[model samples]
Target: MGDLKILICVLIFSIKTVHSTKSKPHIVIIIADDLGWNDVGFHGSNQIPTPNMDALAYNGVILNRFYTLPQCTPSRAALLTGQYPMRYGYQGIPILAGENRFLPFQIPTLAKKLKELGYDTHLIGKWHLGQGYRNATPGAHGFDNHFGYWNGFMGYFNHEATGGNMVGLDMHHNDEPVWDTRGQYATDLITEKSEEVIKGHNESKPLFLIVSHLAVHTGKGGVDLEVKDIAENNKKFGYIQDERRRMYAGMTDELDKSVGDTIKALAEKRILDNTIIVFFSDNGAPTIGSALLDNTGSNWPLRGQKFTVFDGGVRTVAMIYSEQLQNKGTINNELIHITDLMPTLYYAAGGDVASLGKIDGINQWLTITKSEKSQRSEALINIDEARNVSALLTDGGRYKLINGSTVFSEVDGDFYGETGRDDSNPEYNTDDILHSSVNILLRGNLTQEKILNLRKQMELKSCRKSTIDHDSCRYNSVCLFDLFEDPCETTNIANKFPEVTERMKSKLEKYWSEVKVQRKGFLDPNANPVYYNNTWYPWLEDTRCHVGDLRTILLS
Candidate 1:
């Protein structure tokens, strides 16, 4: 009788262990706005110290070949839906203030899908996909709670967008404007709210938190593009002589602190070991003098800056940190797109990827964690409607085909609209610094020679060289470059590789045709009238200005 009782007790213990191991892991995605490729310390930036971010990179896997749209709206839209932005007519153009454009409620977002699987969804920070529309709000998109601004950017201290014809308050908590948060800095407020959410998370179910930070981007209503950092923080960068660069560095420091705070909160809650954290920039940095008052962000060692289809404009900083990673402190050079995160995270939460229909994204969790080669070998397409440019990269980023009129241009002192700054040029080569830093961070697990060899393996030989004329290359024109041999895109080789060029052009044509069909059925924001407070008004109209005024029109 005693032996039989002991056998029953052992059987019960084994069953409980198996159930505990099957619990779903928490997901946390942290995104930075307009963060440059060379901005973080892990990427070999001595100007800005990102110790916390550096630690995470060393403890996880770095995605070396991550790609995104050239702008914010398209990137965010693709990330949430796991589909190409062009499918929904959200190309590369940004959604401006007072515009009727927004993510439609009919579309299913990653948040909505995860919430159905019993996860708490929360968003803390910038939500630039939509504003002023009731159905386009974050709560309507499957987020249980949201605390941030709706527009692209606003004053860091005042929380107001006072640029061009866009002058109004933009901060919000859920659906209502948050007026009491006027004096606080936007970055700190986002951090505080994120900590609160992490601490108050329910233990019974997993959590899905998206912390989209508005840092390293210029503030509105300032003569010289301002970055709102505390006065004491400015003193920390006295060694940097350039005032603008110093201010930018201060902003980056605050962002790094926020990352550390979030990780610390997870640890305090005792859920750090069961959480998967992802960090990436929304798009490449805008270094040209066109927008945001001459942004001083850098995309070093690459050609072109933001607002272009060059490699520097689309390739960005990305990484994944988790205790579940099989090969930590390694670099995976697979070609992964921004849209892949949805399917990847969904699969991580024990959801079936095959059940998702018509998604452009693929599940890359296994490839990233195990350092396995990517199953996708076809070319990846990047389109920018605002610039009339398109590019196709084949042979795993070894070759590039550009179809546009824009030429490769480097950013210098004139780009920043400022003089007397030594670090004004945005194309400094930091390969040696990056290799040394990676070796040290990984405790010599990755040798310097191995890093150099990995880069060399990505290069290819050029067959011929041709001079590329800015006017000669238009929307239909084709230009080819062996990216491995000419990373700067100095020579065009379309004449030598006619077969390859024609094949890539045919692929682009087919893709464009398909997207046009998909876009035709999409809702037109300009045609439909928006209903607000029991009144119908033109979609492009800014009704917030006439709120509580006699000029208001009642539809009833």
Candidate 2:
């Protein structure tokens, strides 16, 4: 009897200890579609209301210099894999049905790692990284539960493709169709499902829910006079209409409310205090002159909008609400990229993330929790071939970078300057399109002396023979500039401060080469076709019939 009692006591103590140590906090990542820095109240927007997001920022750490890949799919890919989009195959947006480009299976994701550590992974919203039909589906990647669309954008009223039906593009609730229903908005549906996911969870384990909403992207062509009329009289028509701006603003308002509802649900369940809620945009706003939505989202006082490498195209608003870190109402200007989220989450959970494998993102928990200004010393930014851009050491709130392609040495990639806007692209009015309030510095500033020294530094840290090879790569080294001094990217100080540019360029090259070696590309050659045969996918399924035959449906 005595021996049995002792054994029981030991077992009870072990059980208690395990429960205490394994009390991992829940994590919620909320990503808005094509949202801009000036679109939210947290960033001083008086036109559109975003109370929930404002509260999140007010009670958390607002990352003033947060960045993301310039495009949607690429940003998602980078955030998921903790690597540059180019390293993987998802460099641009995927529109075709059954596209196979996705983050490699070998690359560990936040969902996969958290699940392995006994957490319930739920993805509730847009999964544009890849279609849900192919091996690109969220379920195949690492998410245990996925309820959203498989493509870039979808209609708000009907869950169908933005305008009409598109094959394999129906709204889904985990490999199942969300039956066609009227009076249901896509944003509300996403929020509803997200709330359900949080409420329905039985708490068998810790949770990691991603509430990725598709609101504020394209407001169904910005119709609906009540919503569209808000922007009255074509207020500064650089690219879009006033009505369209109003419609987009309305969408943002709804998105904010949706976030509020979700937050309310978490608090109702008493999980708000223990959970870490992260809110950020996937990428910059779409800058196409005719696109109704992007024109409405003024990135304001920043350079460029969407698709370009300028600050507006890549820079975004990011905030984290967590009680453990005691991060509230503080603005952090330290340079941090989207890739850093995965590793930071891992560290926050207090789990052994090292054993999972090497990742490009460094754990930035200190920067968030402690409000340490000097946490991040350097960071890099890359967007396909437009620009071979990189940022070197951050010194006292000042950011220095070497911007210019290796082969396109003379070619300036400044998307936010007078030369960049006026000198190129005849189709669109570059001045009207370049809405940035800042200037950009470029190649002319880097003199021959600085260029030579930079070249020598590149020679030492050369990646010309490394694995990540690009046929279009230009000169290996270049000049450095304080973006604040020259946001237009016109000045080439390589001659004056050749040594500084050389040193920074060398650092960038070494880092790029190392990343190239580790991220072996993954490819999927499957053709899973679209859900409905319509105008977008005319080759396959089409829901509407015209003249007794299938014909293209034009959007006015």
Candidate 3:
């Protein structure tokens, strides 16, 4: 009788443990570096075939109005820390190698918060937040395991920055320089490591994996490093004419394949259905005429590109895939910000939101899963500190106001270099493609017509437009646009509605002041020890590099 009772107790305990493990969803966040709004196939890109990304979106919910910061460092910083980057002194700037600027360890990151809830956190690419200082790397920031480069960008093949102020091998595996990964393309290497992590993940605990790809971002070798072989891959991308654009297409294709492989790994591990995958670009594409590396990523139909506060720079491509999502093969046109991810994922993992302390991110699990409308009806602010430009999108991305100017104006052309929008193409069937893809993925559980009806039932809610001209808005004047009516910021109506303009302007000013005060007086990057030492890797004290000597630093 004693032995029988013990056996029954053990069985019951095992069952409860399995149930607990299954209840916690695994989180996979795959971020693309500098991927344009039109870079992927799902976004109506005729040049690049991003089938994997398309498939994921098809089988999940597309965040139609997702917004990010104007630059990589700020966007990433906000995504992880759940605060506006400006609040932390990131301020819409890339963390240049050797700079002491980094996401401070004191701040609670998404990884840290999730890890506290018994999840295994792993960051498997681009940790550009900071590098020179100790505890500035991903490992120091609550990630249990991290593999990839610490700098913003590196040569895809050589794993080194080519001709930058911090040119050196930037690849690392858990804070240590990984020299053996030289000659391996960064995308492939990251995918391989990510699969290993997935396959080897302990199923008893939930997993939080961040596969941040460096693809689509211009490598250290510039346009040449954008793709493996421009000449060879250009043949595959015969549809794309321009050499640089063709290279961009090739790189995007590789990124798509990487996404597909990641999903496959998750499915093989039997964790796909229990995992929530969030995919998005850090920011908009860096098109030609922009000061940043012009990879020729087209943010067409939208004005401006990287470094600007325009929708083209701040608005981005984003999607969330999970079996738990109530709306699959559908677009959630809510105004979702990057900061929301931390709280959303934390809540989905059953973590107490109140315990996260003061964070800018809000729990959008219900909004994301279609259980309820988005609670975020307030203005979403985007600031470019370097340019002193700020944009505000309010009322769920319908009304837009900008307090600064944009460098690039809207361009009219097809991917084949044909001038003007192709009227024949008309409206791209994003819904149809997503529905079909999801139907296939779900094994025809949802018919095309059923999916169409579902979309209609959740018809995209309309928002009012506020338009303003770029030229007139350049010198601190407010530019207003009705983003819903004009997805392209073609017209500005700031003069039409004086009261609305004043209201938004006042709000923008108040928000900016609040953010400025949160800088904590750590505003100057030049004051860092690395800037004085003139070394990208301040931890490498033995390296022969000196202050005020750019030539020696580059050579070394």
Candidate 4:
């Protein structure tokens, strides 16, 4: 009887151990809002110290060429669904009465997919994908525990500026709007919450945490630098002329400290070995207000700001730090985007995400885990209708196409107005005449003939919206440049290679057509954000890129 009892006890213990071992690895995704590719220490910024982010890069797989959508909501939508933003009809940041349109309710997000796999998913900080307005719900999507604001920007100190401010609406902790407060700074507060979630997770099951930080996004006016140490070092920090960058740097400093805290917590909990942590930015920086923000930290040499389709707009800082990962100090330049996150995390956590349909991103697991290069090259297409500009990158390496040079030359603001073309002498590269001509045309100083010729050349062989669409004239002039050859995008080889231009245009149009099918149909059918045919406009009143307003928000 004693021997039989021992055998049963041993058998039960073995079963429990096996079950625990089968549990998935803990996964955490930390997304920084509106951070430039050069903002963090890993990217070689000396103005602000980012020890935590730099540590991740040194110890893990640093993806130097990770790509994301040009803006926040679209990027979030893509990240959550593992699909291109357009596929779900959320190509633009849909807005109605200051409230933006969100990702469609029907799409299965990463939260939902992970939840289906029996992992507890939690989102801490910034939830901008969709607002919870009775019909459109944040909790309804997939996150088991959600705590954050619904809007894109908010005041770090003055909660009144952004509706209810810190205490936002549509927040849920298992279907309850629980007010969770922290006395520390906002960046620290966010990181603190992430640690709590990590430590409180069930030991028997794997965990998935989306630690979305609002640190880098703009707030009130100047930077929100109220930290004790930051104020003392005001002189040294004063080099950053804009109070916004100083405050932003303060926030970033705290954010780095918080990362260290989280790492410490993970170590204390003895789960560091099994957990995978990823850090990435939503988009590029806004080059206004704080010169320190733009001058020292932002992606320089890359033309165009946040809203434009240039490299500065969508190329982001991405790193995956995990002791379990085999790759370290390896840079994977193959094309990868925000949409790939869902499927990549799903696969990493031992779930079968192959069953998920039509994810635009390729699985970067091998590249990240084994330090192997990408098997299939991937490309990214970015569009800014208001700017009348479009760009396509062949994977994340070399070769880019910039379309609609005429509009860029004539009308678009300084953002992408300079096309390296001398409008005065079309055949010459003289900044005095040709470049000056472009400036004149943009300033409304050019003659009718000059404008007509510019329009004609810009429309050649490019895709058009429609015969009546006034913007169609701005549709399809292409400029090709090898990024490795010219990271500044100075030289245009399109004129020399007609065949390459045609091939790229065809490919670009095909991609656009496929994504267009994801549109919400037409605008304003029943007066909701999502109108007829699935078109959802932006939440901000005007979709126009306003650097001033953005700076004000960042400061707040």
lDDT of 3 by residue, 1-556 (tens): 5574355334433432233434899999999988887665555444565656766766678888888887888889889988887676666557666555678778999999999999999999898887655578887888999988887788889877533433567677774667787888888999999999999999988999999999889886544545776668967866555767777778887898788778767765767668899999998888764357677787655666776666677778898988788777788888889999999999999999999888878889999897478877754556655456778877777888987755334321111121212452233344444333222333324444644454344322222124434365564667788777866676778889788788888878777876652232222333223433422343433333334654355446
**Alpha-carbon RMSD, each predicted model:** 9.1, 14.9, 8.2, 16.7
Candidate ranking (TM-score, best to worst): 3, 1, 4, 2
Candidate 1 Cα errors over 4 Å, as ranges = 1-19, 222-234, 379-381, 384-387, 405-476, 517-556
- Give residue 378's lDDT in candidate 4 (0 to 100): 49
lDDT, model 3: 0.71
Residue 535, candidate 2: Cα error in Å is 12
The whole-model C-alpha lDDT of candidate 2 against the native structure comes to 0.58
TM-score of each: 0.80, 0.71, 0.83, 0.72
TM-score of 1: 0.80
The numbered model that scores best in lDDT is 3
How many collisions per candidate? 1, 39, 11, 34
lDDT of 4 by residue, 208-228 (tens): 888887767765332333453
Error of 1 at 491 (Å): 2.9
